[model samples]
Target chain A: MQKLTKEQQDYQNFVKQKRPKPPLLKNILMAFIVGGLICVVGQVIMNFYISRGMSPKEAGAPTSATMVFLGAFLTGLGVYDKIGKRAGAGSIVPITGFANSIVSPAMEFKREGYVFGVAAKMFVVAGPVIVYGMCSAVVIGLIYYILKL
Target chain B: MAGKKMGLQTIRFQNPPSIIATSSIVGPKEGQGPLKDYFDLILNDNMYKEKSWEKAERKILKEAVEMAIKNSNLPYSKIEYFIAGDLLNQIISAGFAARELGFPFFGIYGACSTAAEGLGLGAIIIDGGFADNLVVATSSHYCTAERQYRFPLELGNQSPPTAQWTVTGAGAAVISSRPQNPRITYVTTGKVIDMGETNPNDMGTAMAPAAVDTIVRHFNDTNRTPDDYDLIVTGDLASIGKDIAEELIKQKGFDVSNKYTDCGLMIFDPQQDVHAGGSGCACAAVVTFGYLYKEMMKGKYNRILLVATGALLSTTSTQQGETIPCIAHAVAIENL
Candidate 1:
């Protein structure tokens, strides 16, 4: 934090005191319930795929694809955001939220047209995650190779 | 001849310019707000049949100006100048609106303080004999402002409770040399005050100090007190900033608690799920031109101090770790 003037510091303290805080317990409970429900849905989908004679390991990719499709479809339908508003981190921490993070911006910026709008802006929210995720995977792969050596 | 300049920051108009007519147009959300009846037009959709939110905002501003002129019984040619601003970058909403207006335009940017700034300058022009008739207008759109300032419209992130919703509306007023009931008496321009606040989300806290500073200066320069005006309204302090401004003003030896409120608070009902309240250039604009103007005409408030506050922080500045600089301009409107 930057250093503040005496008056600014005092006023900041006063403002902090006066500001209303969100209900922490209520939010936590909501996140738990909503997040648990999302996981249950994923589990059910996985079980359905497994029941169709696919091995559990083989069913994983399709289950994930199905979850992403659901997330993107719900976002297109303008319902995922409403769910996210109430669910908070519950909605955000899941893989579906990742799909939402991409599709939402794509839809929002579509007004600028196809090339510059939807294509360019689709990864804006998810760009950092993709970059860092790729970088870390490379680093871990190098470490694994070195350990084998 | 006595100078028009008051104590320090205020100007006392020798011949107060009158707000002869006003027009307010709002989106569906603000239409559902408590002051719905006061607005001249309420669109069923925020898009208003436009291709983009920016275009829609420009149209809203343009219509509001035309409607105000029509209400004033003044021909379009009679309007000497067009002074307007909006929350958009380059003030494009007002700039594009002024393009179609064909009047000598003064496209200004004072963030949310555009309404008061336009009115103050418009009044000065009329009172200074620069022009007889001018239209002062301001507008803001929620979708445009959201994408520009915070996040994309469809971003599923939760806003803090202190975060305010930007009002989607436009307000315009016809200021004339003709005598009328509600006159612009005094104007107090504020200095940029930074209280070391950096958070862009909590604008209320950042701007409260500036609002209080302007309010105190207005009273001091005009030799007036809280009793002098029936109401003292801030632009968009919402709940947190309004409370802070009231407390700070009291500390500065002015008791405006009973008479003070905010346009941010006035625009949206408490149960509207807008977190703190409504904000943006349109917040004060619509409330003043629509709700308060109608109330003033009905003799509910004989005089009022409209202190419009603005946080002068850009996304680049915020990203650069700079504190939010804030300003406020106070305009005294009295029925004489």
Candidate 2:
């Protein structure tokens, strides 16, 4: 956030004009298609659970768990990241991405041994999400209680 | 009073040291690149049977050094010094490799420019009669660099268009006083230049100015133009930085576009999908030692200016909102 001198600023502008911009349209399209497919798959799983005599609300938790398991499985098989690379927001905005966020560091750091490696690094990427998620949930819950809604 | 100095920031070596031998080892991805055939060893996997990527990188460096020494037809005891570096924190790759190699080690860190830096220093050591034979080596791993500088390998984030793929490889060259064809003649060291660029994902932009600065300085110091050399190659400026440096150098009254190219652009083909191209300590190292050196041996290029560029920014430095300071080291390797 420091102010750049005129020479630096001019050079930066020159570089900016040269740098390639990402394909926004293609990225958006890929994210939409891949994200939609993942949602459809989740829907099918939920419907299957409903047909098995479980209530829609009761199936929600299992559906998410199944999705998480699937995510972890695909990550272990090393397919999710390849999809994520091109899918961009599609692979990342889902519950499966949450699984991927945790499992990836776990696998990458496995060489450091189980304790400092797997266990320690498992939450590195996901830790922020979990901490912020819980904090926001608590704040929203307090607001909800106060508003009685 | 002049001594060995050639203009400011440039050194004219007396009795230039020759590159007796070189070796390159690349991972599966880089092995699939355009310069695949130039490499000495291509691993099927990045891990190379090692338990960790860091250890794999160390092994690659060690193998490259040993292979280069072997190729030089010199016994292990002949190499008096080992100058090595890497992109890893503490340069552990070179440090660990040196520990096993057991030569008088000089562990250096010049980010991606480590190869050229090592080569310049190694040449100086040999030319100065400090050592009869010495090795200059550098290595960089995509996995290690990613985890160290950016994100985890599994993070599903998209790399920007200007972002570069870290070349997973190691390159080593044996420099000695023995008369040889291609020799290191002059070294134009670079001053750290920061153009107030802060985007870590776009290192090409950050390092381009430094590359241009060193290139211009090299031209001024040596009183040579682009026509003097068959090629003027930058380390890892890739697509974006290459263009930027090309234009900036032209603006500085030197038109090297005809002979100019980059290691980053040479390593990967257009179909490789490596955004801006390749970047890493290994980028210049592998390309120069593998492709260029072999081509030089074939007498394809008489003189070449190898300007290796590096962005000296750590994860901590970027996080602290500091501008990336970049540098380039130019070494003139020619058929003498």
Alpha-carbon lDDT of model 2: 0.93
The models' CA-based lDDT, in order, is 0.93, 0.93
Candidate 1 clash pair list: none
Q: Write the per-residue lDDT of candidate 1 for residues B232-274, one digit (tens) a residue.
A: 9999999999999998999999999899999999989989899
Misplaced by over 4 Å in model 1 are A144-149
- What's every prediction's RMSD, in angstroms? 1.3, 1.2
Off by over 4 Å in 2: none
DockQ of each: 0.66, 0.76
User: lDDT of model 1 at residue A67?
Assistant: 93
For all candidates, what are the clash counts?
0, 0
Docking quality of model 2: it rates as medium
State the TM-score for model 1: 0.98
Q: Candidate 2 residues B1-336, lDDT tens each?
A: 868998888999889999999999999999998899999999999999988899999999999999999999999999899999999989999999999999999999999999999999998888788999999999999999999888788777788998999999999999999988799999999999999999998888899999999989988987988899999999999998899889999999999878999999999997988999999999999999999999999999999999999999998889899999999999999998
Q: Which candidate ranks first by DockQ, i.e. highest?
A: 2
